[model samples]
Structures are given as C-alpha cells and as structure tokens.
Target: MTLHATAVPFKDGASTLFPGGLPARGGVGLKPEHFREIIESKPDIGFFEVHAENYMVDGGPFHHYLGRIRADYPLSIHGVGLSIGGESALDRQHLDRLAALIARYRPQSFSEHLAWSSHGDLFLNDLLPAPYNARTLDLVCGHIDQTQEHLRCRMLLENPATYVEFAASTMAETDFMAEVLRRTGCGLLLDVNNVYVSCINRGRDPNAWLDACFASIPLSSIAEIHLAGFAQDYDSSGASLLIDSHGSPVARAVWELYRRAIGRTGPLATLLERDNDIPPFQALLAEVSMAEKIMYADAPRALSGEVCA
Candidate 1:
C-alpha cells in the first residue's frame, strides 16, 4: 500500500496512473489571448490547463483574468520547469513559487515534464533529455520525492520526446518512468504525441513502443494524457529527425496513436497540447471536439471489449 502525509489520504483506486474518474477532455496551455474569448464564448471544454510558471507573478492583469476564469473552470497546473532530468539538484525557489500558486488557486490536478531545463540557477527554458540509467533514475526519484514533500500533493511527470540516445543507458523509457512512480509515489502524464514522435524518429513501431510503456506502468498511476504536434527536422547530413515542436496541427499518425492510448488508459483526463503556431480559439476547440469524438466515438465497441488495431 502507498503512504500519505495525513490521516485523510489520496483516494485509492484501480491504478496509480488514474486515481479516480478523469474528466476525459480538455484544452492545453490556455493563454492570455483567449482568456476573454473563453469567458465570452464559454467553450464546451471540460477542463483548463495552465503552465504553473505563468501564474507566478505578484499581481497583474494576467492573474486578474485567470482568477475570473478559475472560478468557472476545473484547473490543472502543468509545470515546464522543475528540471527533474538535470545533473544537479532540483530548484527549490521555483518549487516554492509553484507551491504558492497551488495554494492560491487550488488546481484540481498538477503535472510537470520529466525532462530538465535549468542548470546552476540558469534557466535554459527548453526541456532537455536524460539518459536512462540507475544513477539518473535515483536522481529523478529523489527529485520527485522532494517535489511531493514540498508541494504536499501528488504530481505527474511527462516523458520526453528525445532525439538522441546515450551509449551507457541501462533502462528503457517505460522502466525508468515506472521505477520513478514506484519509488516516489509520483504519477505519469503519458504524452501520446511524444510516443509517436520518438517512435518515428527512432525507427521503432509505435504500437510496440506503446505496449512496452503500458507493460511497465500501472494504469492507476497515470494522472492524465497529452497529445501535441511534432516538427520534422533534417540535419546537415539530411537525415530525418522528429522534434516535439507543438507548432502545427495534430499529425494523422499521432491521432491514431492517441486512439490507441485512450483505448488502453480508458477515458483518462486528456488535453490538446499546442504551444507555438496556436491558431484561433475555434481551431483549438475543433481539436478539442475531435479528441472528444475519438474518445467517445466507439463507446459501445469499447464496452463490448472490441479492440482496435
């Protein structure tokens, strides 16, 4: 059994990935540009996700708008920093700021990327990859432990869509993430788009990779799911590299993979992750509607135990 800090504890459920019933639909990275539109239109999206760092301000119009919206929407705090993959220790100052926001807003859920961003108090602002090994695994678990201890809540870690592999690596992505969950009581924020990007870039079968990831992680630990766009990269040697750019519309292959993930995870909290090249609010809402359609499209078949290949 898992341990909790207080007498009243995290609600026990079927799997660690999903502690309870998830809202099953949402939009990603709700920005200031759409704040007024969201309230005016009140798009039918189930939940709203925010970058935890964005709300770390003292007092401003941003917070003012966010407060108005917060009253209406179920919120999820997704952190881009925290640098769990860094060689050095996690940044306490950043974590303190995050904790303060959580206290103020009381988000329904919280998450951060598994990759690192800063080094030695300097912020790189890009999620960098980590080599999977026992040392790195231990380091990551320690960071997760510290984060949960300080924040006083369960957090989600996202897998990185990596470009390179280390020769000395001793574990696969699935095993590494599962180990972290087991050791630190943290949860997984499975990004289906990342899986698709990594599989295409690394020349692996996406389905096989998904199976490997699912085999390692217990579904109970999955707190949420992510879907985003990837940029096609070519180097000086003219080789193809897929980057998690989140700059375009959802790729066709990614949508198929998301269907597969939704099948396995079974209606977990889901988001459409767009950062750069974000179109009008309607375009994203269309994506949101598409995701909802896919998630509930074949409800009867899913109930009857019919699996799609």
Candidate 2:
C-alpha cells in the first residue's frame, strides 16, 4: 500500500525517491532548456516529469541536475519506448534499463503510452496506433502485466491521439482500456488533449467521448492527467487533422475538457508537455499556474474558510 502525507504517498517503501507521491497539482515537463533555471529557482510547481528514454545513460549533466531537483520536488518518469501495444513480447534489455533508472531515481510515478512503436526488432521512432480488438486487447494486457510485475510497481498507461481508426476494431477505446486496467491492475494517465485531438480528427464529439471514457473507467483508476498543445493542419481531403505535436500553448478547448476531467476525477497529478519549439521556462510555468488555478477552484474549502493547504 502507498502512504500519504499532505500530498499523496509514494509506493509503500519508496521513501527515498519521493517522500510522498506527486502532489495532485500542476507540473511541467523537465526540459533541458529549463534545467538550470529550474534548479536555481526551485519553482512552486508540484512535480516534474522526464522522458525515461533520455536518461538511460551512465552519468552526465542530466543526472547531475536531476539529482539536485529530485531532492527538493516530486519526480515522474514517463517512458515513450515501451511499445506496450506491440505483438512482439516486451524487450528484456529495455526493461532492464528502465528498472535501473527507477531504482536510481525512485520517481513518485512511472507511465508509458498505450500505442506500439516496435515490431519484430525494428523499432519505430514514433508512437503508432493499434486496432482495438480481442487479440490486441489480450496482447496489451499481457504487456502491462509483464511491465508491472517486472518493475515491482504499478504503471499508468496513456491514451493515444490517433489520426485514423481501424474498421476491424471491435471495441471502443474506453472499454478496451478499462478492461486492461481491470485485468492487470494498472492505472491511467488521462491525456485530455489527446481526447480532443482524436475526437476532432475522427469527426466524433469530444464531450461525448470524454463522458463515455470517464463513465467506463473507475475514477480512482486515473493516476495522472496530461495537457499539451497540438499542431493544426489539414489532411489530403482538406479535413482538419490535428497532430499531437507538443509545440504550442494548450488549446482553449482542451483546457475546458481538462476542467471537466478534473471535476469528475478530482485532483490528480497534472502535467504540461512541451516537446518542441521550447520556450522560456517562465512561459511554461505560467501555463502551470493556469492549471493550478483550475485545480484550486471547485476544490473543497477548509472549515476555517481557507482552502486545503
């Protein structure tokens, strides 16, 4: 079982990496561009999330600065190369590297994407989508089970922002995900922007999709939330195709979706992801402030009239 302080508690005995689990407040992606500023300023954000693949190294400035920040704030290690939706088995070597990093950093939370990025040893450098059918469902569950058991910790699976859908799909994304969580006991990293992007691309109603997904899954199954900006574009047919490119400010629609998501799930670890066209550190922090404000609102006030500290 996990322990809780004023913040959520870390896994039973992971007192060293994080004294407590990441606070259910706004956090920013730990970018190399902001490392110095972050370490020097020690901003008031709840935590920081790092791409686990980038830190599978021996030692360097990355580790140096991350070590310093880890001492002062909560950390979340998010992985992009797990390919949990692939047909092939999980990569043993890659899993070992991830295990080593978790043992070293002891991040408060760990997560990966639901999409696959590899096939038969040829690793694709992108997060590709998969069909939502019985076969793929079983494959994903097995992978999640293997990952959680091998790491000896629970992991959160993120939803993918797909540009297309498979006619062969037999299940809705929400149902497939809920079943996986039930079977493997893993958690969810709900990405509100992805939901909006996918819904827009597929000509589906974003609000309806959100309602379906949230209704299907247990609220407690959500371990974290992600907000990011997407690049707007058009496909061959001139239909709007929003790419999940984390290069701009969070869209107004996504922010509204996030408001509703938090209303349903309550406070959870929220992250702002900006992977390209990186900007000044404070700019991202400003966005973090917006998210923190939303979280603070609708949040129950204390008996003395002060908000829960």
How much lDDT does each candidate structure score?
Answer: 0.79, 0.86
> Lowest summed-lDDT stretch of 10 residues in model 2?
1-10
Q: What's the residue-level lDDT of 110 in candidate 2?
A: 89
Q: Model 1 residue 164 lDDT?
A: 78
Highest-scoring model, TM-score: 2
Collision pairs in model 2: 3-9, 9-21, 10-21
Clashing pairs in 1: 15-220, 16-220, 16-221, 17-220, 17-221, 17-222, 18-220
**What value does the lDDT take at residue 274 in candidate 1?**
83
User: How much is the lDDT of residue 203 in candidate 2?
Assistant: 94
Question: What C-alpha lDDT does candidate 1 achieve relative to the native structure?
Answer: 0.79
Q: Per-residue lDDT tens digits of candidate 2, residues 70-141?
A: 888889999999999998889999999988888888898889999999999898979999999999999998
Query: How far off is model 2, as Cα RMSD?
Result: 4.3
Model 1, position 225, has a per-residue lDDT of 83
